[model samples]
Target: MNKAALILALVAAPALAEPDAHALERLVKQDCGSCHGLTLKGGLGPDIRAQALAHYEAAALQAVILDGVPGTPMPPWRPLLTDEEAAWIAEYLLDGDRE
Candidate 1:
């Protein structure tokens, strides 16, 4: 492949490397679990179970995941995730599907 093509491929690699279910599950169980509880039942943060999240809109939850709750322990994950990833996480949480 040409140098320019190689460069383009490299640039596109990260965007293509979206997390899979296993990775997402690990993130939730490890990272989010730190605050939300290992089972996401409730911890320092509020419970984020599917039923608990029923009152929240999916978009609103995605916004919270991306931007975080201001003046709270929740920190914005925008830097660490794409909008799609945030939406995925929000949907995952709402679906109550845990690996």
Candidate 2:
């Protein structure tokens, strides 16, 4: 393959690796739970249960996860999480499928 073709192929390739559900779940339960409450009801941060977050679109939730609420104790997670991971977490939270 020519260099240009190789470059294009690489750039066009989708990131095939799905985010680790187990790890993300753990992160949500542990890291997020630390502030959102063990049951994600309410605490120092605020209630993050699915019902409480029904007003939010998944993308908005993902953005909050990636960038955090400025001036709040919520810390940006972009450095530690990929966009895909953040999306997964958003869906997970919205789905209210926590254990």
Candidate 3:
């Protein structure tokens, strides 16, 4: 393949991976909860409960998850999660039904 083709392949955005709900729940409870608090209430981080996060649209929440807030303890999770996974997390956070 040509160098240009190879570069495109390397940079081309992948389709969002199918999410694993159970695993993602565990990730939220463990990874995100480490800062947001085990119950998603305020801890080292601000409250992330659904009510507290109501102002954030899903896309906005996804960006925060993937890119994190600058100059804050909220570190970027792009390396650890796919776009879809981050989106799923955003939905989960927004969903009142979530545990």
Candidate 4:
């Protein structure tokens, strides 16, 4: 391929850095797996997959992560997780669904 074509291809290529599932899993396991399953199917907590985070807006996801669901085993993580970390977890699950 020509130098110009190679350069264009490199530029147009999709982002190669997809989020890491293992790292996400580790975070979920450490933070959520005690209640939710290690795989995020279910445990003491309700099935997060069934909840379908894809349906939720980023704001809604943030609310749940930060404030936690009421009348459930899910507990508010405001003190435990910074807003940025919570947002990352929410986006990871909503966008990646590594489980």
Global Cα RMSD, each model? 4.4, 5.3, 4.3, 11.0
Candidate 1 local lDDT, 1-99, one digit each (tens): 899999997998786567576777789889999999999989999999999999989899999999999999999999887787788899899998545
| Runs of candidate 1 exceeding 4 Å displacement | 1-10, 13-19
* Candidate 4 lDDT (Cα, 0 to 1): 0.71
lDDT for 82 in candidate 4 is 60
Point out the higher-scoring one by lDDT: 2 or 4: 2
Q: What would the C-alpha RMSD of candidate 3 be, to one decimal place? A: 4.3
Q: What TM-score, computed on C-alpha atoms, does each candidate reach? A: 0.81, 0.82, 0.82, 0.64
lDDT of predicted model 3:
0.90
Candidate 3 per-residue lDDT, tens place, 41-95, comes to 9799999999999999999999999999999999999998988999999999999
lDDT of 2 by residue, 10-42 (tens): 886565257889899999989999999989998
Count of clashes, each model? 0, 0, 0, 0
| lDDT score, candidate 1 | 0.88
What C-alpha lDDT values do all the predictions have?
A: 0.88, 0.90, 0.90, 0.71
